[model samples]
Target: MFDKAFQRVNTFEDFRTELVEGKENRAGEELIQESRKKQKVDDDKETTELKQCLEIIPDEEEVTIDAIPLAVKSPRIVDWKIHKEGTKSYYQIIRADRKSQMYMIFSHMLKSFEREHLEDLYKLVKARYGSTRPVESMDYLLWNDMKIMFELHVEDEVWKLQQGYKVLEWKLYDSCGVHSLMMQSMQIYMLVEKKYPLTPPTLSMMLERSFKLIMKVKWLISCVN
Candidate 1:
């Protein structure tokens, strides 16, 4: 009789142990599932933000060089030479077409620095325009931004020159002329670089190219970071 009593007690204790272990295992599984769901939600949010940040207008029409009207009087052949002023070196292309008129300036610098400058410009645009695409009228704003960027580049070049450092790969150009003539000259300059020798592009085209370049730089930076 005592042996039977002891065996019944032992069976009850074993059953309790098994029940406790089963509950613990279920709790652990629930925690793991919850963690996986949270992780997936976080990932989805990041992807959505990235997509919004990189949004671009589709099939936007561009004004080609051929569309621009030629100047009534051909511009005088301007002389270009490397100029050094107070630790800054740049190509100075004088516009002899008009006396005392603004001439074109070209500076060569490191491609990496150029990319960073473009990224900075992208940030400025995003801050002003948010996720909305800029309108045609807003092209002037972009041009202004580019002008500021070039000015900053000039300062940077001066600093680098002072440090006895010289870099090259990317070219920066600034000029003033009749809109059509300016566009033509710019297009010619770009084409000459590529050895294609084609026509010039409009102000809008130049802005569009700058926008695309900024986008590319931003995308590359995101990948690296």
Candidate 2:
């Protein structure tokens, strides 16, 4: 049971002492030269290992097929907001230059789409812009199908109609009677024209405004009669 078949393993201090003893036994010039060469090889290996470790850099966050920005303008959209409930991924986008105008687009049918599609889009954007920066926001969540929520800068176009209503308001103040009532109705018609393809709620609001103006005009006519 107590058989001393093998020598005990070298401790750190014991190993260093043995190396020193071995060096002392050798010819000083040749042994010193050989030890220096071995040390240099080990130093080179360590430097290489450190360089390799430093070369490994961590990756950053990337764009995917879940969200993408678009170049369009609409009043309905609230700029920079992601509308998730109605569609899988709906975004109220605006051009980088003009935040006053905004638009909306749906990304893909499924909440989770293929990553390969995103790669394709990335390539396409890179090719077109010579860099992904132009479409950095636009191309990320892009899908084959896209629907423009409203015409480009519809808000700016609506301003013209607003100017017309202002003019009508000025005329109403100047002439209070049948003339003013008719002017109010004219402005209401213009409002209807300005907002064509109106939703049911919008149409109802327009009709109500028009109806009230007509009632006022009829009341004026009856007072004269």
Candidate 3:
């Protein structure tokens, strides 16, 4: 009875008109075309909404966690890319700055790594920077558990560390009821290296923002109700 559904589908516009306006849509060809068109429309809608949401203006709020002052140089983060594989997300970051000195100093830290393997990266840092006589093995991965993000220092000039694996900071948002939402930054650092360099002094700083993705999930579910 439906054999005529396909053979009569000559012009695409006519077939689509039948498919959408009535039940006489072609069974095979027109169905595929209609599916593609619907998908494009959904994709366009999402793109527009995302642009509107992220256009929020940045606002700086006064927050005090530690005794540390709110005066911090805004370290520029560039080419922020986020990849979600499973439950957790992986971020590829790049940090760009006005002075190449910052990048050059960062390369010094990488030279401390003797092994090409990642497991030994923490071990290498401890070996190179013998602290107070006893050098205990470092747990780099465990740093994540403590909410430590990334470590940075420029031998004698600059040294800083963040808590979140990404840069988490509160920006002032006028639209939000309070003022700001803490935004975590995923950044990458790049520097021109001389290859073999001296051991640069490395320092770690704890971030004030205590963000737990797990906790956020629960809060989100509550809002849905």
- Cα-based RMSD of the predictions, in order? 24.0, 23.6, 24.9
Candidate 2 C-alpha lDDT tens digits along 92-187? 343234453223432221122123322333344345545233333434433111111112133433333433332223122211111111222232
Per-residue CA lDDT of candidate 1, range 88-120, in tens?
545333334633222223222112123333344
Q: Using Cα atoms with residue i matched to residue i, what is each candidate's TM-score against the true structure?
A: 0.25, 0.18, 0.16
Ranking by TM-score: 1, 2, 3
Task: Choose the strongest candidate by lDDT.
Answer: 1
lDDT: worst 10-residue window of model 1: 176-185
Q: Relative to the unseen true structure, what is the Cα RMSD of model 3?
A: 24.9
| Model 3 ranges off by over 4 Å | 1-25, 56-69, 72-225
Q: Please rank every candidate by lDDT, starting with the best.
A: 1, 2, 3
RMSD of 2: 23.6
lDDT of each: 0.44, 0.39, 0.36
